[model samples]
Target: MTEALSSLAEAFKNVGVSRAYGTPVKVVGEELIPVALVSFGFGGGGNSEAEGADAAGLESVAGGGGGGFVLPLGVYCRNGSGHVAFRPNMIALIGTLVPLVCAVGFTARGILRTLRR
Candidate 1:
């Protein structure tokens, strides 16, 4: 059980969400697993009109791309003793990559604009 919990914690730590509360670490049969339930929260502090416009822009871009990955960790335990394992959901990975891709795209666009001028 200790080893299983250690392994499960290690996995979550790698993903930078280990600090998130309510993260489940469990053992099933011979497997140690981590499960997470995520819900996005939209803040109201931003300018309402700007927020709406930004949402619209995101919706348009979202339609053109494949839906993002959503990784949910669900640990299942029956009795007590079990192995340690995890299935990584890559939605966060995709979310991370999007900003990187956009940065590259904007840089390329800027270079092109500079060359054209």
Candidate 2:
């Protein structure tokens, strides 16, 4: 289990915010650098059992699993004025904000109820 966790930690060493930014591309004399939202998760577990008393035992069991995903947020591009700007994906922004908005609304509702009481 220690080795498994150690390897998982090592895997993340090279993954950072910079990984979310893609290399720049040039089109029509303009440079565009893509940016994205990145997230990752990892987990591990183990189990062991003894079959008998003294001098008798069974081998241990172990398992591990991990997964990750990324979402393209938008890109940084130079406008006609030659100034760099960020242009976001409306749908992605909405999707990211909806859950946050719902959480805030629920918290506010709970607070209002408590105040009234």
Best by TM-score: 2
Q: What ranges in model 2 sit over 4 Å off? A: 1-13, 48-58, 79-81
Error of 2 at 62 (Å): 0.6
lDDT of each: 0.49, 0.86
By summed lDDT, the worst window of 10 consecutive residues in model 2 runs over: 49-58
Q: What would the TM-scores of all predictions be?
A: 0.32, 0.73
User: What is the C-alpha lDDT profile of model 1 across 19-106, one tens digit per residue?
Assistant: 2224444434343345555433221122334546775764222111112233454444334534344444577557667999999999
| Clash pairs for candidate 2 | none
Error of 1 at 84 (Å): 6.5
